[model samples]
Target: MTTELERELKQLIIDTLELEDVTPEDIDPDEPLFVEGLGLDSIDALELGLALQKTYGIQLQADSDDTRRHFANLRTLATLVEERRVK
Candidate 1:
């Protein structure tokens, strides 16, 4: 069962990245967002981060290890966004 935040994050990722071949339901919450799982690369990460910051009004420290963890997967991303979303 996908949580509301997870569903929202899936859509956000798809829309933000302009992934025409992917849909929200195609994403597994526990799957890694990069490399083998979603096949996202570093550039995708940067783009997604910018979109996340713009959408959630959350400040992300590029050099922080926590930031990497937050971007680990859809579940982690959703948790971070839910905890930090301004509106």
Candidate 2:
């Protein structure tokens, strides 16, 4: 179940970020997305937040204390949606 969530989240990240060189398998759920692993920047975070808002109907309050915690990685992002998204 969580694997599926991870995959879906990975796909969403790749699609939303326009990562032409990356596949769903390229992402590491526990790795850092901003500094090292996937090399995402601030703009990418904003884009991802918008994509999540559109796709999962979950809004991320920009620059909040929870934003970093929520968008930490694919796992965290998926968990955030699973926890907050309405049916």
Which numbered prediction scores highest in TM-score against the true structure? 1
| Candidate 2 per-residue C-alpha lDDT over 1-87 given as tens digits, one digit per residue, 9 for 90 to 100 | 348878988988899889999987788898888767999988998899888888889976656678998878778888898988864
By summed lDDT, the worst window of 10 consecutive residues in model 2 runs over 56-65
Q: Candidates' lDDT values, in order?
A: 0.88, 0.84
Q: Native-vs-model 1 lDDT?
A: 0.88
Q: Which digits, one per residue and each the tens of the lDDT, describe model 1 over residues 1-87?
A: 799888888998999889999988899999999887889998998899888889898777667688779989999998888888897
Given candidate 1, what's the lDDT at residue 84? Answer: 87
The list of candidate 2 runs beyond 4 A from truth reads none
Give the local distance difference test score of model 2.
0.84
